[model samples]
Target chain A: MPRKSSRPTVATIARDLGISPATVSYALNDKPGVSAAMRARVLEHASAIGWTPHSGAQALRRGRSGNIGLVLVRDPEELSREPFYSAVTAGIEAATSAHGFELLIRFVRGGADDEVDVFRAWSHQRRVDGVVLLDLAKDDHRPPVLEALSLDFAVLGHYSGPEDFVKVTTAEPADAATVIDHLLERGYDGCLQLTGPFEYAHEGRRRELLARLCAERGIPHLHVPGTYTVDSGYRAFQAADTSLSARPAVVTSSDLIAVGALRAAAAQGVAIPRDLGLVSWDDSLIAEVTSPSITALSRRPFDMGRAAGDLLAQKIDGRIPGGSTIENSPAALIPRGSTARP
Target chain B: MPRKSSRPTVATIARDLGISPATVSYALNDKPGVSAAMRARVLEHASAIGWTPHSGAQALRRGRSGNIGLVLVRDPEELSREPFYSAVTAGIEAATSAHGFELLIRFVRGGADDEVDVFRAWSHQRRVDGVVLLDLAKDDHRPPVLEALSLDFAVLGHYSGPEDFVKVTTAEPADAATVIDHLLERGYDGCLQLTGPFEYAHEGRRRELLARLCAERGIPHLHVPGTYTVDSGYRAFQAADTSLSARPAVVTSSDLIAVGALRAAAAQGVAIPRDLGLVSWDDSLIAEVTSPSITALSRRPFDMGRAAGDLLAQKIDGRIPGGSTIENSPAALIPRGSTARP
Candidate 1:
């Protein structure tokens, strides 16, 4: 293998071909200024001499880093246990790598300030060509900051900011309506919605929609706020069980929460679908494997991530992405033993 | 906010200060050539102008990208389902971000060739200062390629190749011995080891150790090889159940596989611990929450990841990294209902 310094550079190729460095560069990069014959000659010579472009210098010249950034503001413990984000990440990786871009990920332990700081640093450094944003919060501070920095980005959820920002939305207003309709169709008298943190925009939107739908149907709706964790789900279930006079059908924002509720039900000797019904959002392998297997809304997180990646890549390449809002396949409710009883 | 071109570069700062760009760069970068007063003045002026280092230019000048890479070669379906890799990623992120480095992750869908291509590209582009490798094969081809490219990296598992490679190992020979001793004490006359694919170095080591231990103890040892998925575990269990004259204590390579086994056992109406004792490797929330809560050997994957990130960072910074082998906190066996009878 050639040593670092011994590796052929653009300058070496230019000198070997007895041409101006600019002409060689334009030819090698396939710019319009170079003639077809000159371009072919430069390409042949460069290939023969083994001249690979230095990514850093290329990034500086073109002002493109060939990277897509993803900054996740989440509890590390919560992130580790939940399969939702990982699936999304896998999808993003699939799409980005296909487009010759790498995924630059950062996990912020702190709140919005830390997340914004990351965006600022990335923007100033030109570390990434574009970013894919997740876990958007109600009154999110990131979009405005990102806009101010003139960085191109795509959000995974609804962004209530500029009309131009690309969004890949899976959760719709109809999602909560479907869950409530399922509960009502199952002959459930009341509903207990175990939501993810209220700070999240999706959770808040879900809460509002569920409340409105329940009110319309005259179903008693009780909301419990918790993090996206099994322990949080367990505690929320226990709290609802003791506070309410009757057991209500539980609808969780995430499957981990549903698993916790299942554990709680087991401990309390409350039979699933018989004594109480459960429906988990974000269906995964965990939902399918549990005893009495949970009823869940399958969102296909991988597809969502892939869409976001595609949108961001398009935005980076100066293309007006076909759609600002790419709607994912509608969330399909998979009825299992947990919601099998009518 | 300042427009992209208007943002102050070192040349702009130098021009404003009537000094050479080299002197400005030296002062800004804390290099020794510049005087203390000049360094202070440069810092003050740069701060006043809101100048942040252009990452690409800084990288070119310093020969550092300030990024660490992790390339995972796995099925996307399996990656999404299993929580182990995600947790490791979270741990790595924690350590890398704390040190002002970002994590660049790539998931390769194909085998060794695809993975090597990624390494070659990354090395050629100078994209990452170092990388963290996972799921090493017995005759892994990555290390030699990385060494040839002169890329700095750390392995999460054992490397059979060179002695100079940094290895952060959580699995040990004694891990299998412990499991066998537990099964023997539980009066299990035979053993069924449901292993991950034989390609992984860890699985091969684990299989060998289990085989040797079972031979030494005069117990019948049966090995079933499968992927690290729930379906694999379920099928392995079914095959073993139908083939074996007597039910043996089953030990799985992963929690998802164990969950599949538990499901199969439930389907077969086999009473756990009494009819068949089961222990899962790589304890996770799934293990703790499964029906008959599976007994498992808990390897803290997050800690292992953190150690790997630290090692890679040190290696990139030109430090010998104190120790070549970082033995993670020993895998602790967390006995649950599956082994409660014994």
Candidate 2:
């Protein structure tokens, strides 16, 4: 294999330009020691030769790595099945790139120790100037860890943890009302919510909000535990007693889960909207393409990601405004065939 | 906000240890001048002080940044809608993290020039020691650009373009034959393949292989354009001639496309697997959850990503074996209700 020519150093550039190394350094660093003509000559020649001052050297000089770290605490299968991570990552990338900073992403199995270890490595190595935390779990360990290390970070979801960090949260809890109202208006007297695992911070909030609203209307409601996967959704439906003549309308936490319920309904010969009503959260393309075009609340995941990215970038820039938490636009209900009038 | 104290320098450690700074430097660099006892003391003191040699300084001293760059050249919406990117990214992250390297991922809107610019930045800025490239296109500009810069890279798919980067390819073409055979076994004499945009390198290979296999069996075949999105799949099916009494079975490039076809079929009151047999590529969770559970070929995007990441890491480590191209495991067909017996 042919070896690449090593990056041209100041010495080499100075030699090529017949100038002293100190003179070249002064010109490059804008130290005002070199004449304008000589500085122009050195810079123009450096550009011609594709000589970029090494980032490592630049970072050492400025005492900043110019990087933002993000560690995902989910298994590969779970992360892949959901589009939320990818959408948020795209938004984070856009913001980081605009600032000439690179985002360093890692996927770690959901272990608090593993997460804390990652933070320690970044802190010791100075691998990032800041970090963006996602998927806030109950008893989240990251905020405290980051705080103890004196590292600046921004969490992507609301956290009631002890440490203070910029928080960017979606109006996920508020969307429950929108979903329930639509189901109620369609003449579904009672509804069942297949929620994600309770360990997740947002899932608890979503369930509580829905339960409160349902109680207010004196309607019966049940919360079935789900794992945010299609299989879980299917099992949740099967677990519901079919003997109940007044089976409640179904609402799922994710589009994949809703698709599963749709599959189970089709298998049972239950006609959608006639025999059963369904709604899926997170209006991805799958919701629109499914049979009966599953009703959904457009979470606008991309915009949420963008907002989180913007907030993290602002925190890094030390220009974040007064509040620590930001509530992005509320999700709006997009009633489709599944939630249409019977 | 309180500023973080600057990283401990050799001088600081030496002063605290009551030793000369030169002795501390020599001990840290493993030079002969430092005595064993003094070296141990300096090291322990440095560790106690939470001191780490700056990565930038170390990279400048050793001429390598412990990073790998990967840029996705796709539109944000397209990237988010497909599970392939997230799955692959997880795999890549797994491999990179295990090797103690960070993956710098960028999502670039499809522009050849922008991709080339990213490579150049990584090359000149010394941001990463090596890179992993994805989505090889016809007349790909990246291979040549990387080659000219003498950058070490690994392409995620086979590339016939001018350049000698490591190549990792999936047996996507072979999967085409599998889908075709499955269709033939189902008594379908003709099939229409809804493929992604022709410019993508894989699409042409997949289409040609399927078309050739169908021709050998004296079966009629059609290639309809698709964009790997649900909307495009729906549009492709809509654009097909329904007046033909015997419409061809449908094979789509992605699961989203197949879902779109399902939507179109439902709208026309056409029963699946009875009136129309359907198959989707890239078996994701959505495929199993959809009504009739669309039959699909498993692309194993996560494995593909891991392969690319491993190869790039190997190249960086100078341990890569002989050939530049690696053929990954061939995709396998998973039959389900969508392609059940008619």
Candidate 3:
């Protein structure tokens, strides 16, 4: 590669024009103090000199980095394996790019304290104009840290705090109601829910909603705690299958877990939607391609991401106040072969 | 949110110390010329006042942004659907975060020109120290643009150009050789290779390698152009099935396409591995969970990403010379039910 000349700075242009750097800065930035002709002359000279504004300098002056941050406090293996985070990220990228902002992502391998440290650093350094938060747990500590730091942000999950930031969520109770209604309509007598970690706020909400809905209709319901992985789903299904007298329709927190249940049923020689019924929480390609295509709640994660991105952008620009809520379309159940009971 | 006071800057510390800002900068940065006692006094006072170095100012002085960039020139829908990009990104994050560098990602919905424009803007602004380039096409224009900008970069695919840039690649020829060997061992009479778009350099290479290997072995080889999507895979399989006289074993460029082909076969009553053998080029969850789990070549994209990240980091730090090449572990064929013909 050819060794190129150093980039031209504001001082370089000022030196060429024999003018004060302050005058050039004011004229180039279109500040009010500079006369129109002076501004035009400064711009022309700066253009001729091939001077591009330094982003660092520009960010410092404007108090905006033109970047948005996303910190994922997830196991790297889990982050890579799950499709949910990726789709949401793509959606966020779609919206942020349309607004000419870049996404700065950091993966935290450690616990919540390490995640908080990242936010603190970004806040102090002004590395991003704002951020988007994901995977809200019960009493998530991140919101309070971000609030104390005065960093503009939007959450992708429900937060129960008094001080409301922008939250983009799917209708949780409606999701549960839809699932129970579908199961009852299919003539399933009992329901088994394979839930994600109860530490997550959404998981707790889903459990409570499902339990209440099942009780009102006099349907027996069982709750099994599991992580969002295929192994978790497989084990949960095996444990449920052996322990229960009657096979209940299985509802999983994610498609991965549903896939595990499908594999387990196939291995055990149990016919799906006959001896067993399976429903996945988030629909993706995985749900559609399984031997017995899984009935799934299409949460539309990409749209959720787009909504969160737009809200955060608005929050960053001070166009919208805090405590705003935008509910994405409620999760709609797409029944496939897995739940096709005759 | 609390109404917090503004953050303490260097000037604030200087004002509190009744010293010149330059002296404070020198003391805080631990530069020579400050007396030991004076430096200690300045440090104590700065710590007492909660003064932190502004990242913008520090970057301006150091000419490093403490960030790396990755640009994806892909359809947003495609990006969100494919697990490959996400896994690769997660791998990149693992490496970059380990080195204390953040990942800056920008998705370009347009063609190559728009992608190049992102590079130019990022270069001019010093928004990233170096970038990782993906999906190199025939006669790709991006390398030339990045080279001209004097930006340090690493390519994730083969770059035939003479200028030595770090490249992380898999053994394309070996991938073809192994697939053919696997097919022949399974007693498949003919081969139908469903490929991604020919515009990509790797696709062209794979096609040539497969064609040559098949010709040498006198195996009837057919190639169909598709994309890294399930729908494309479905359409390609349907077209191939109707046009061909005898059903040949199908090999797809990605798991999504394989899933599509599987769906098509199931719809048409073509028994997998018995009537038609199926293999996916990239192993993923979709491949593993399909009705007859797909036989696939595990490309280990995450490892590829990690390699690319490490190379780019080294390139940016000037630790390694240009033209460095790192070949990831060869793609291994994982035999599953899809190719278990007796």
Candidate 4:
């Protein structure tokens, strides 16, 4: 490693350009005190010598700092085992970067009490321009708190009982409705729906739709209490096998769960589609990336992220004019080797 | 919606305790300007009402602010598509948190040219106590500058040349050796190793070990480049089958790569252990959680994270006497259903 001459600092830039250190700070901040000519000179000298402001200080002064906070309300362990959030986060970054806004991502351990502390601190301290909130429950504490504070926010995959908030999500019961209806039309006598925890807004809808539609068509189902992980999916299949009168064709709330069902089926010497039909949610890179490539209802998390960022930007800029609502971005189905009639 | 009497701000704490704002600031900073009795009074009042110092204001103070920085050389797309770095980072966080240190993570686009600007600003501004540098290349530019300016750091994976640096990583070659030797002992006559990009330090070592060990054992085997994702792994296997003298009976490499290989084998109508035996590296939760539960040489990332954090903490506290190094924590062989004799 070669040692080169030390690069110049703000002080060096000020000295070379015949300006004060305070002036450099003001120019960098785009503050009112610095004259246009002086600001240009400072910027030029700083550019040549390199002047980067302490982002924290800049953030403090300009309340509209280019920082968007991301709060993921999920188990940390579960998150690592799943890829949807990461892909969505990546999408959010894609949009945020276009506007030079930094995403200040923090995970909130979502047991009611912890989420409160996490939300309050982040929102109250003005640590973010807005937050991307995920997994809203039916009676969400966060929505009320955020609404009260009037914090700019965009919810991902959760929208119930709140029309005043901005949300970027895929179709909920709509996708489930479509998949379930497809199952019924195929003359599947019985169905097993492996869903994420009931606390999850979307998964809850999936269960309700499966139950309601299945009842309307007079078909029975075993709703397995599962989370959005492969393990949960596998466990759900095992639970279904134990509880069901006979093995039923399956549907999962996530592709991860779908994969698990496939594994469980294979393990039990059950054939896919031939013996057990399966359909899942969030058809992502993982949908195509799996064996037999399970059929799934997929949404572009990248597009969802971009839309969320745009909506949050609208709120941040006060363009939404309050109490406005964006309904939902729908999900599309991608068929593969998995779904088949019993 | 109720404010709950609001969180005690700097002003609120001062007013409630009947002390000057400056005195509260002084007490918060643990500066010598405040008397012991006054400090205790401030502490008592603040704790009763939960008055934490604002992180933004605290970061503004010059020098040794107790913040650790994480520099990721990958793009946002990688952050989502690639789980390896996320696991490694989660490990780093495990270490940093145990020592009561905060991590400030940032992403740098492209190479060292503009990145040097980012690093210079971070170090000179004392934005972090130390940096954890990842993705080292041949003729790395970071180490020399870090030492010259007296910045604290922990290098992940590897360093360029012979420079002494504190690093925490799995012994990839040894792990590879163990896996290969296990496959050979399991009555497999031939094997295939799907590896990450050859330029990467971890993948390079694994590739070399697999090749050398195969030669020494006189085992007929082949190596293929894997993109460290399921899609890539599948493609690599397809390409390898065209030129191979015989189909590989055992497949191994990094977990993600192995996952791809597993899919490819399945796609080509190959049966596991019967037609091919499979194993993987890192043992990330996904591997254990995957179908057939990939047999793996477990790196045990959580413990690795804890170890990395311990070293980083010692280095931060000035306890380590020299360049940071820790003994191999030993990789555990996690045999799942993926590997067996024909």
| Best-fitting candidate, scored by DockQ | 3
lDDT on C-alpha atoms for all candidate structures: 0.82, 0.79, 0.83, 0.67
All candidates in order of lDDT, best leading: 3, 1, 2, 4
Off by over 4 Å in 1: A1-8, A11-39, A48-50, A241-247, A321-323, B1-7, B11-23, B29-36, B48-50, B241-247, B321-323
- Cα displacement (angstroms), candidate 3, residue B230, comes to 1.2
Which lDDT tens digits does candidate 2 get at residues B21-94?
89988988889977898889888888898788767877777767788888887787678878878888888888
Tens digits of per-residue lDDT for model 3 on B1-342?
123425677888888889999999899888999999999999998788767666677668777777899988778767777888888888888888777788998887887888888888888777888889888887888887787877888889755556589989878888889998988888776788898898888888888888888789777788899888888988998888433425468888888889889889989989888888898889988788887999999999988999999988887777898988898778999999999956
Taking the candidates in order, what DockQ does each have? 0.51, 0.51, 0.53, 0.28
| Candidate 1 residue-wise lDDT, A126-176, digit = tens | 888778889888778777677777778888986555556888987667677
Q: What is the TM-score of each candidate against the true structure?
A: 0.93, 0.91, 0.94, 0.85
lDDT of 1 at A126: 81
RMSD of each: 3.0, 3.2, 2.7, 4.5
lDDT of 1 by residue, B83-134 (tens): 8888899988888888889899998778778888888778777787778889
Residue B86, candidate 2: alpha-carbon lDDT: 82
Candidate 4: RMSD over Cα atoms? 4.5
In the order shown, the chain A TM-scores of the predictions are 0.90, 0.89, 0.91, 0.82
Instruction: State the lDDT of candidate 2 residue by residue for A1-342, as single tens digits.
Output: 324655677988999988899999999998987899999999998888888877887777776777888877768768787876777788888878887788899888866678788888887777787788776777887776776676788778656566456778777667878888887788776777887777777777777888888888777777887777777888888887543336458889888788778878877888888877898877876786577788998877777766777777787777874257778778888888897795
After superposition, candidate 2 runs with Cα above 4 Å error: A1-3, A6-9, A40-51, A161-164, A237-247, A260-276, A321-325, B5-16, B41-52, B162-164, B239-247, B264-272, B322-324
How high is the lDDT of residue A152 in model 1?
80
lDDT of 3 at A86: 80
lDDT of 2 at A331: 86
Residue pairs clashing in model 4 are A283-A298, B95-B309, B273-B276
